[model samples]
Target: MKLHYSPTSPYARKALAVAKHHGLAIELVASNPSQNPAHLLAVNPLCKIPSLETDDGVALNDSPIICEYLDHLGQGPKLFPAPGPARWRALALAALTDGILDAAVPRRGQQAFPMDEGRSAMVGRFQSAMSRTVDALEGVDLSGPLDIGKLGVVVALGYLDFRYAQEPWRPGHPKLEAFYAEQMKNPIFSETAPPPA
Candidate 1:
């Protein structure tokens, strides 16, 4: 299997971390989606990073889907829960974390342009969403084996450190901060740390 990823992409980091955790033998193909690379676009019409090409000529796009596929390929404890209340809870938490990235990535992109009232409003909205989401996550239990939800939180916080280090996210959220710090010690995360932009 081959994973098409950008070193700085948090979404790509999620998939890569899952593969690493499961000890999957996958090739990392450095790709820049911004360039509309033919290899990426051919497999994923959305031209997104973190696209996975299976050995059987199958392509999987989207970070969650790619992570799920990798989870199935391994023998470790499941990253995604089997169908049940736990599954729903895990999926919801993962979605909340991914939502933070959804807002943050575009907000970062908008920074390249001159600030306008509209752009400022959008940035403010994204900031508010991320702040509220982190606060909510502070109360959630992060115990038990690592799952998709926990991985999502790890990647989301890492992205903030990578792109929005100046923003005050860790001052009051000690639990979330601690969780992130602990996860950073994992080989999967430490080894896959994003390159400096």
Candidate 2:
């Protein structure tokens, strides 16, 4: 499978991590969907990174879908639960994490739109929403092996590195700091680490 990706996209990094952690053989094809390239539109109408192109030429968009698809291919070391409360917990965390990015990614888009006129006040609103999400998730228990949801936190951290480095989110959140430092060590994350520069 070929994963359309940007080096600094957390969503793409998550897909890469899942593949790496499970020892799956997949290829990463760097793409800038933001550029709205013609060829990319054929694979994914949404024009987003982390779209997985199956061997059969099917394209899968969105990170959650990609992650679930990757999990389906894995034999062991699953990131999500089969069925039960644990699954719900992980899913909730994943949702919350994604929500944070949903807001930030756009704010990021606005800030990088090349013209201030293209930015919107709602972009700042979305950024505030992400901040609240970080606060809400700060109390989560992440003292053990990471669940898919826990990875959501790492995804957000990577987003911060990509777009919100000056946000001062970590100094007050020890739980997340400790979790991020340890989680970042997993080859899954380390290998796909974003290029902040």
Stretches of candidate 1 exceeding 4 Å from the true structure: none
Highest lDDT scorer? 1
Top candidate by TM-score: 1
lDDT per residue (tens digit) for residues 1-197 in model 1 = 99999889999999989988988888989999889999888999999988999999999999999999999888988989999988888899899999999999999999899999999999999999998998999999998788999999999988988899899689899999889889999998988888875
In model 2, the runs with Cα more than 4 Å from the true position are 112-120
Collision pairs in model 1: none
Model 1 alpha-carbon miss at residue 187, Å: 0.8
lDDT score of model 1?
A: 0.91
Among all windows of 10 consecutive residues in model 1, the one with the lowest summed lDDT is 188-197
Please give the RMSD of candidate 1 to the true structure. 1.1
What does the lDDT read for residue 144 in candidate 2? 62
Candidate 2 lDDT, tens digit per residue, 68-92? 8998898758888879988999999
